[model samples]
Target: MAWAGLQTALQLIYPPRCLTCGGMVESDFGLCGPCWRDTPFIGGLVCDLCGTPLPGVDDGVPVHCDSCMTTERPWQQGRAALMYRDSGRRLVLSLKHGDRHDVVRPAAKWMAHSARPLLREDTLIAPIPLHWSRMARRRFNQSALLADALARETGRTSCPDLLIRANRTRSLEGLTRNERFATLMGSIRAHPKRTALMEGRSILLVDDVMTSGATLAAATEACYASRAREVCVIALTRVANES
Candidate 1:
């Protein structure tokens, strides 16, 4: 396998060092046992609608957050691995800026394990698209990489061009929630040629980090607009308690 060979070569040169503690490790993902265990894995009392961890599963509030209650998301449902803590932040940063594509496997494996029951043979896995300029600048889309990893792990087909970013907007950092939503509205659209395949099909939208749910909401709207029956989002991490 190419990844195995690559891992071998990388180990031979740089050796494996844990991302959390910088300790020697056998794997190429830069994670040590203690750090891996310390990584916050989201479980228990999760929302039925968006799958963000809820305070109680059967508290009888119907498992929707304040944001979900106020705003309608076109996606059918969604789930994320962990809250946006330091560990998740470091993992995403490594994948995005440190070129640590190796993290995709472990991250996507966890996502796939959680998403298996939600996926079907006919389900289409797609990644949230980056603007062309952003993709060119980064030379890769972290979402696409995650989608590919999920597809390989789950035996699903990943359609890279299904969803597209129509326009590039300013970063949402430091922006108010309303401003973020306004800037994100209609920023994504289904690729014209792939519109036919979208109708009446279930899609799993893959993203690395979700904040304010703005980007996922916009992508879900575009998918629904393309006539998709159901869209479910899966992300590595999400901003917790953003109500």
Candidate 2:
């Protein structure tokens, strides 16, 4: 009863606001109705490999997208919470560059829902690693934050430093698929000290966004090299159409 009273008092002092619009919302870490409608939360049929939304209904059978058909994905399966557009884009950029730590909780909830199919008793959660130089500039890895929060929500073990960026690579902003793959080919590897934790475990790699999936491929390969029994991936958002 004291806690309830305290919560009521706190709500009076600091009312909840929408995550994207800053409009008053009923609860914390939520979007206003308008923003929620605008956000492209992925659902229905999706690619079995990368989680891109498909045109048909989910028939209880896994299907691949056009991109996944031609391109190779190192991970066994994947899922994403949103399409990288509209409010989804805004949310990811805010978390990545604007230091919006509050976004982690809600984002992790969505990711956990999307990743329900991929979870296992022996699963270990890890993030796509950032280069030390980049980490120094950014101060935090958004992916790691998401992975840790997701682990908490899913009742799984999280290893934030399971993967390390062995080589510093340039940004992949404008790189083609081939170039992006080439740049990240040997850039990521499993941490020597954490390799034992991954052995015979199903690794669930988390990332803030999936563009060309080059980074995820690198991270998945690293997990495989560490003798992980299987690897699956989840992302906060995915670029619907790769250019």
Tens-digit per-residue lDDT, 90-165, candidate 2:
9999999999999999999999999999999989999999999999999999999999999999999999999999
| lDDT, residue 164, model 2 | 98
Per-candidate TM-scores read: 0.88, 0.99
Best by TM-score: 2
Superposed Cα deviation of residue 9, candidate 1 (Å): 10
TM-score of 1: 0.88
Query: Per-candidate RMSD vs. true structure?
Result: 3.2, 0.7
Root-mean-square deviation of candidate 2: 0.7
Model 1 residue 176 CA deviation in Å: 1.9
